[model samples]
Target: MPDLVPPMLPATGELADATDPARWAVEFGWEGHRCVAYVRRGRVRLLSSTARSVTGSFPELAVLAEQAPPGGLVLDGTVVALDEAGRPSRGPLLRRTATLTPDAALRAEVPIGYVVTDLLWCDGRRVLELPYRRRRAELEKLALAGPAILVPPSFGLDEAELVVRTAEQYGLDGLHLKRLDVPYQPGRRTRNWLRVPLRRRRQVLLAGWVPAPGRPDRIAAVLLALPGPEGPRYVGRVGIGAADADARTILAAPSGPPPSAVPDGVAEHARWLAPGLAAAVEHRGRTAAGRLALPSWRGLVPDDERDDDLLDMPAAGGSQGGGPVSPDPVRDTGTRARDEARSRPRADAGAEARSRADAEPRSRAGADVHSRADAGARSRTGTDARSGAGPAGTDAAPVPAAGPEQPGTWHGPLSRRLEQHFVYNTLNTIASLVRTDPPRARELLLGFADLSRAADRAEEPTIRLDEELAAVRAYLQIEGTRFGARLSAEIDDPAAAGVDPGAAVPPLSVLAAVRRGVQEEIEPVPGGGAVHVRLVTDPGGPSCRIEIRPADAVRDPFVLFSVPLDVPEGL
Candidate 1:
């Protein structure tokens, strides 16, 4: 069969609050392995996301060859096996994908159907650059359908929200939003298409398992983690539900070293497993220690599946709590040329900065240089490098050099930080609100988008005081959503405190302080607590002070960070 490449992957993000139906196409997101079917002379070959041959896994999909147009065509879609009620079944789907060449009996038992979504190659021509609307129209003209083959209908843009609800009601993953005007982008995770997941689920690596309380052979909970630089970094464990028999059996066979460095108590009873075992885990929130909070088993992840989604480890040369931590909806997009050009210089600078940081001693001086290097790299790339989380927009203008009027773009001792746990927990919080309080969920989702936009400017050392306050507000609002009445936060206007609203302060300084306070004061307390952040001009120097403290406490605030009021000459 002719070679067929994997299709474009959608960037994860929420639907834009102000999306125009005319400009977008909405489709129910499928929960299955991405497959691209290549038909040639009535023969068929199916390729997975990693370009591995999966034709034998679903023999029924070969009917697509008979349904194809005169010339062979390449179709992109997901292969899903359905349950009794017709919802996509993750357990059976995993079994089908892992078996590779399932016999006729196995194929019949877990019959998989191909959900054709996009057309890539048609009439011996690659249609990669056609606008989504035109490409979709071309796909529909082929009339590709059969007993095991499907051409799922794309919902109109006006039905985006309705589609999301329907998907949720039917236990589907979520909705995929595609820009009608954009060309099909293959391999690249662009913002032209966006994925909004109604459920808060993650694929986690299975490091080991804890025996059931009374029955030693039975699993109480399975240890979970993501692949780390040295080994699997433990996230948290999930209680094995009745449906997790497959996961239990895999965990029963221990192999390799312990998944991660476990605590003494956990290490005593924890059984280790070989790498490659992973599971779909659903959780509510995260613990203070960054572990998955109350995770439950979903299904086993096939070994052949790529771990791109499971590789949540922090990127090299980044802060412990700093990286691209926003959920899929926060991605930004730009031209391929611009991205490559911008990335090359930043990569070089980042390498040099890392080298300098490594050579320097663990002192404020070293950190100062490191921060400056990071700031320099970010300033150079500017907002053009930002990934699109909403409708694609024009590239943002580069930040002007620091001057008397412009805020200085120089990171100081305080660097921007966004914890990965926060992203996951915030998503879980949004997921929990979807069914019972969708309005609240949408509000929080918009708030999260705002916060993500703010965090995306991590390279900006300073921003308008009002912007910083707004970010702090969004941060607190999402936290409140997650914590409800247990956690309260307030951001008093700097203007009320006699500070200039237009003045610039280090980006994320106030947010980071509030985050720290929430972690230390509210999260640790059983009853939770309140955090208050307000800015005031320093009495001692020409700088603004951000005081983060407990709202009801009498003790002095733990940490006080200052933002310089005056830009240095010739900076």
Candidate 2:
């Protein structure tokens, strides 16, 4: 057989200096079918984001091929579903294409627009070298005067965010923010684009680690979880483990203090961990689908509350340490713990006092969520919560004012951020099942369905899975190698100084996630292994660099993709 052609790369990392505006151009990202389309000799080939073929389903676009700019070219466009109005309804289109055939009547009535935004091919030329503006210019002139495709509007970074806001408000899919300067990276999901969409947050439990093969001390990250369709969902892991000096100092210490209780499970493997050491965890999001979005450490909570207590909150579950309101995880929860979360004689007064006295602004200083109106978010679960909206465990969505019924719209950016997290974690939870107990995975997912319907939503997973997911993520990483999971995560720790016997960093679960993301390196644990993956964050923040020790495979000194604030100053 002839030499096999290698698959084109799907992930790209540019030169280190990407911060320069001149180094980047920004564009509003559109929401629709994420396909990389190509046309040659009046023939169209529609591909999934993963490059799988799906041209048969989009015959309308195929028929309109005669109108494509007369040459071999490709473009990224959204095949969006439009209602009677020109408005976009993403979910419907995705459903139709994935599940059924769109008949001519339905097709004509509910038109699918190939909204082209970028031009990858020209009549007889390739516009790969041109700046974003020039390539888009080429696309605008394409004589695709057919009912199938239309050129979507474009805007700079300043207006892209506006586009994002408007789209969500108008029932369109989320906006996409792209870097205009980069070349047309075929099949590459470059960081040039940031999908500015809203979603939910799901907090998870951080478990154990699966060290990257070669790297020492420097771990890939750890395993993490949240309750999922399965018992406990394996959202993913931090991957890069206890490498940072400060992170290691904090993580190792929290595993001990005087003497840890040494749970039978933790004692079986991991070589360390006194057991009773309970730290707080913070995950950036959760999805109705049961995935942990962006996750990382908030640091060790006071040993006072059992770790499960931190995991079992009615609202922001599993993020007690260094989460939401700032204070000693131990001391902070102290004043509020006994205050009767459900029945407060002076609840409003207590909320106002805690809101102000704690100085924990409804949101953080630089947090994007800061833009939210306090009255809108702090109203118990929502304004209705303050006015007896339902009990904490009942409301799927509690908004400040009962506006038109919007199913997925959470309150503020924080709420939106949380929503995004829920999606990511839900997926992770499913993945955790696939990784840990491939056989029992179905059973686990069934349980999650039960939880989704149960009134005692306050409940969580019974499984303790830090190490299990780590092994599974390893398998996933190997498969996902073709596509990059570029994660941007941030973890913070406020009261490490108060840590008894120690402080901790991204936690074991974080390390496991990083390890699993890279794939190939399947470590041999004393017990069975797991798969886990975590998040990657952006740049510029105060942090103590925590570098894992020399391990077998990982060679990079430190991959500082996140900003963690939980570690104490020094070892």
Candidate 3:
């Protein structure tokens, strides 16, 4: 067997506005860690894109070795951790990746599957020079299917839009387009193979670290910057757990020059680091100022591995584009509880936010459902609570316009960054329901569509309390579907049933807290969990209170301020 080598990489590219069906083929871009599998003599070895061995991280994939035909074989694909709904999820996969040799308990908790998309070598013959279509043909002939291995079909260019829709429905990363006639070039990011992401993700250079508020000795978040013609351009910071090994790494690195023109209110106590540190960060989109909104740290990687070519890549048709008004995640804004959550494992807001606000943005169509216009212009057409359009009179509440300083105003997007896995899991859950309970599936599907619009809406910093509640309800509905009998949710919003549902509240205010409850309180419980939401209207102002029941000694009921003064900061 030959020594392992870096796998071929796809260059960032836009889907061709016009394409010949015979020349292009598309595959769903699985949102998991990429790997190359080499199977020989009933043994399998996995290598990451950096050519680092990671076989121990995914013992479940060893089934490939047993299924391999006579002679060794080399395959390239992604190693995905499927959630309960059997959707490819990055969080579980990251957990596995963080620990190269996870214990059996962890392994059972996060079983993974190998999604083989390319065949590099088979029957002891190298196929790197073969055209992609031929290589795929050879790969399919192997009939690679197992408990943990799969070979998904590719679509013709004519089906690209359909494929994109399917990927969006299932919360996939995006689509990978390959030139049917081109040969696989090892370790090259070429235009012949294009990567179109459904959401924004990039390798951000770590500029430095910042101390958690009131804790000078502890590292909280890492400042982010991007290489530019002038110099390193300051983007924003992404919060990290103080105890994370990554935090220690940032603290130990020597100081480098500060990024050009660090934004005010930031960089006050930032400790700059020399260049070379980088992280895989994902966000809903860029703010009006080009700063990342809801940036979530995926993991740390060597700066040299940063894909400079992928920077500035334009979104393809049907892709989710970033909005202009979302707040930057680097700001210090939220409650101390949220800050502490940011310091835990999977510390980003996505997980803390029930992965609803944390999950990937919906399709362009879902985003367009709600225009950025004020509450009045954002009404839904249907009255049915379960309808995809969402509850009737979605914008029926007449809200007094308030400035950002108003106590009741809720500004900014969700508290956490959007992740890809939750979206996939939600879709998988909905898909499974289509057969077992079609009506329930339909309701959840519509509810998800409603939540997607809320998640992707490019709105003013403040949204109507009703809209926020609607998004929260949609998320609960989806979670209910995922957990089924294990979870139950109830919303007592008498204020919404009456008038004034349009009271302006910060975006993702209640949702973020609910997400925290579901993630920390509900999801972890063995017998399942319950979420109870109550809306109380008093003279002070209308307050939204969410309670995640079956709490432990450590966790209390989640409570939202009657009127949140500001959006939670630092996703």
Candidate 2 residue runs with Cα over 4 Å from true position: 1-11, 14-16, 27-53, 60-74, 77-117, 121-129, 140-289, 293-295, 300-571
Model 2 compared with the native: what TM-score? Answer: 0.33
Clashes of 2: 101
User: How would the candidate models be sorted by lDDT, starting from the highest?
Assistant: 3, 1, 2
* Of candidates 3 and 2, the better by lDDT: 3
Would you estimate the TM-scores of all the predictions? 0.38, 0.33, 0.41
Worst 10 residues of 1 by lDDT: 377-386
Model 1 regions lying over 4 Å from their true place: 200-571
Local accuracy by lDDT, each model: 0.57, 0.38, 0.59
Going through the candidates in the order shown, the clash numbers are 10, 101, 6
Model 3 bad stretches (over 4 Å)? 83-87, 199-571
Evaluate residue 458 in candidate 2 and report its C-alpha lDDT on the 0 to 100 scale.
15
- For candidate 2, what is the lDDT? 0.38
Top lDDT hit: 3
lDDT tens digits, residues 1-571, model 2?
1111111222233223235544443332345676667776678887777667777767777755576555567766667664322244454576568645667765544456576667766666767668765776666566453445655445444333343333332333245555666566554455664554433222234444434457644445555544332233344554433335424532443332211222344334342322322334434233323344455544444333333323332232233323223134322221222223213111111123222312211122223122223423111212322232432334432222111131112223222223222222332344344435544443433332222212112122111121222222332333232232332222223233222112212222222223322221222211212221222122322222212112233322222112122212332
